[model samples]
Target: MDRKLQRSWMMYDWANSAFATTIMAAVFPIFYNSVAANNLSEGTATSYYSFTQSVAVLIVATMAPVLGAIADYSGAKMKFLRFFAFMGMAGSVLLFTVNEGDYLLASILFILASVGFSGGNVFYDAFLPHVAKNEEMDRISTKAYAFGYIGGGILLAINLVMIMKYDWFGFPSSKEATQVAFVTVGIWWFIFSIPLFKNLKEKKVGDPTEKRDKSYIAIGFSRIGETFKTLKYYKQLLIFIIAFWMFSDGISTIIRMATFYGSTIGIGTNDLIAALLITQFVGIPCTLFFSKLAKWISAKKALTLALAVYVVIVILGYFMTSALHFYLLAVCVGTVQGGAQALSRSIFARMIPHNKHAEFFGFYGITSKFAAIIGPAVFGITAGLTGNSRLGILSLIVFFIIGIVLLQLVNIEKGEREAKALEDPREFVKVEVK
Candidate 1:
């Protein structure tokens, strides 16, 4: 509940988002398509980028639960977070070395960076409940996303200027300017991370128990089985996770693929990056506004409203043909993208047993990451077969629709009630969270 602690925790979101904006969502996709994959056809390059994203998520999906289990017992969430953050930073810095026609290297580095980003997020998310009380979760989560947008937007704007006007930065060409931007993402991430590591402490993980006979890896695999057995006791929360997987996949795909998809259809790099910058700046206020909306209408209804807007965005993306269209679509997306995700995260945190935050969030991460795989793969394959990425955009409508349906079924009150009567999976003994 301390303001300083909350602000420190949120700063991680601000720091890491630079990489999200500059490397993942905006600049690199265009750079990859035009430079790294220069020799390949547009469709092939897009397909390759999509597949690499899938592979990275898959790898992280496999790792999430085990690390979560270990962190639960060891209270090593911060350690795991530090490791993945470093991995992401290294990947970002290494990206500066890529040269023309180095698509293979680019794919490998992207995969490495993506894994680090998603993997670190699992632990970062686990810290949410620890950082805020139940009542504070929604506000803090949305505020965190707002901070991300602002931090990421500032960096992207600077990078945009550098790439568009290389002479101002003393670069030999825009290519060199773009390469330095990649290094900046790494530097920005590391510098901003200092506050959280220095200021916050891991207060508790779960209730203390005797040391396990098994290794953390072995416990991780066993916990997955045990967690499923416990699912019957918290059905509403399980349903929410399923809904999150469906909708989150769609949300992630749009963020990951939008720039590349635009470039594939012939939008200029500066315009593509510019529109995304608009999304970032617009998202800052909209994310906070949705947090307020969650208070006014409840998190569930607010999230549902956001998902509804996404359906409109995807359909519009299908018909997008000009820079103005992309810019308009970006504005629409900024309005709801962070709101849906931030609300979903807070709602999940409230429903899960507080004693098992890391483990449940781990399961949450793995499922969502695996779900993330389907969207890009679907888009890539759909585009590859049809030879049109716009159709791929059209195809995402089903996910949001399915998610909205499932979300309606979640009874938040019931989930919170079940969480309060916590059951220790190790013994099936009921202990109230207090």
Candidate 2:
């Protein structure tokens, strides 16, 4: 890909990530549970929130594989991206329409938006191979994530100011300002995606071979079946997937539950949002630093280091009894969060067959969605059973440990050789079809 196109593609991360920072990670959940569901009891609101998030993950997990297969088969990744992007933006815009007592409406819209956000990532990740070479991928992927953190942080900072300084804008309270922030995320997401549509080439689908005898949907299901059947053949990939599923579960749990945990510990809302904003910005430089670190240390070792940091963070959470401690922990998490995730994506992309990028990334999406489900479910359940939410937070250490152990078993050189063999120019053709 040309430099312009690569930059354009990366900018999409800048565009869509505001939603993750402001709405999903930082502000909107608290707004929904506290302001939108103000009429409901605390337990009921928490239950509704958890249920909605789980439903969204379930839908994504069920559909992502098929959706990815179709994108690969059709060679219409950008088209699929546009479809999901619209869904996400539209759902976000609908958030502004939610009233204080409209908990169910808010929950449903949030679920829709979450599905769109996660689903869009499947196609977005598939673009990595198209845009970058193996040598450049880790840096490019990490840079995109770094840009995402900056973008998300910038928006969250502005939103935080808006909410904090509501009286200056003639808004009656922080809640009203927060409603406006939801609208801004929708607008931001929609506006930033335009560059990708304009600049990137649509990947061309190959002409069907004479032996290819299935309808597209049939091919999709067959491919999915093949993927599962061949899982054992790719031992390193399978192991990495399991490791990603486990460790990312812990990461997702911490992100999704952080606000609630802060509230449970009597931290103020503004303080929690401020801490999250700090993480977003802090993640920017750290992401870039870790990308460079990957060149000196292996990506796997770097990720292991990040997971070690997570273990420390989880341990610290057990001892945190004050807002200052939460702030300190947030800074530590910010340093590793973006870098760890970016390296994971790049590493997995390195292992998979580029010809079937979307199909494999679809499986990647499935693991991510399923992992999201597992983390929150386990955290919520353990928190309920123990009547001590911090205990649930601490339980995440086990996931990090397991993931690190599994990661060590993967032979990176072997995985690279297999991918390169699949990509041998003499063995492949780029036949274009109408």
Best by TM-score: 2
CA RMSD per model (angstroms): 2.5, 4.0
Task: Rate residue 261 of model 2 by lDDT.
Answer: 85
lDDT of 1: 0.87
Residue pairs with backbone overlap in model 2: none
lDDT by residue (1-434, candidate 2, tens digit) is: 48887888888899899889888887788787778899999889888887888898889889888888878878878888888988999899889888888999999999889888988989999999889888888888999999899878888888888888999888999888988999999899888888888988875666656355678788889878866765555567888999999999999888887877888889897788878877888899999999899989988899999999999999999888988998999899999999999999999999887767888899999888888888877887888899998898888888999999999998877776665554432332331111
The runs of at least 3 residues in candidate 2 whose Cα sits more than 4 Å from the true structure, single-residue gaps closed, are 208-215, 422-434
Report the alpha-carbon TM-score of model 2 versus the true structure.
0.94
Candidate 1, residue 74: the lDDT equals 72
Predictions in order: lDDT: 0.87, 0.85
